[model samples]
Target: MDIKENVKKFIQSELVTDRKFADLQDKDPLISTGIIDSLGIMRLTAFLEKSFAVRIHDEEIIAENFGTVESISALIQKKLP
Candidate 1:
């Protein structure tokens, strides 16, 4: 699957309880929308680490790095090299 699709699936399975994450389009700001909190952020980072086979350092776990699905996808792509 593509990055956006993978991210959508991850959010649906990981965070959404009902149809919450479904409203969250690719451009929607995850943190700003209150879809993710501090704990959620940590969980997402951990998921990315395991899912993408990338080691996410403590310093790299920041809002700027995972502001949205697109940003996280970019980080994953960067980690591949």
Candidate 2:
């Protein structure tokens, strides 16, 4: 599946919210939208690690990495290589 599709599914299934993350023309700010928060970041990170098979270091878990679906996908792509 494509990155957007994977992101959409991850947000839907894991986040348990059919947010407009996939529909927005601009990057959806998950934190600002209340789609995710500090605690939610943990869940997102765990999901990304498992889904993308990437090891995220403790210091690497930041808003820049999980702020939006696009950013998260980019991080995954970076980690793949």
Report the lDDT of model 1 for residue 28: 70
Off by over 4 Å in 1: 18-20
N/CA/C clash count, model 2: 0
Candidate 1 per-residue lDDT over residues 1-81, each given as its tens digit? 976778768886887665756766777788777777787877877887887789989898888877788888888888886
Q: Which candidate ranks first by TM-score, i.e. highest?
A: 1
Off by over 4 Å in 2: 16-26
TM-score of each: 0.84, 0.77
Weakest ten-residue segment in model 1 by summed lDDT:
15-24
What value does the lDDT take at residue 12 in candidate 2?
Answer: 66
- Model 2: pairs clashing at backbone N, Cα or C within 3 Å: none
Per-residue lDDT value at 60 in model 1: 86
Colliding pairs, model 1: none
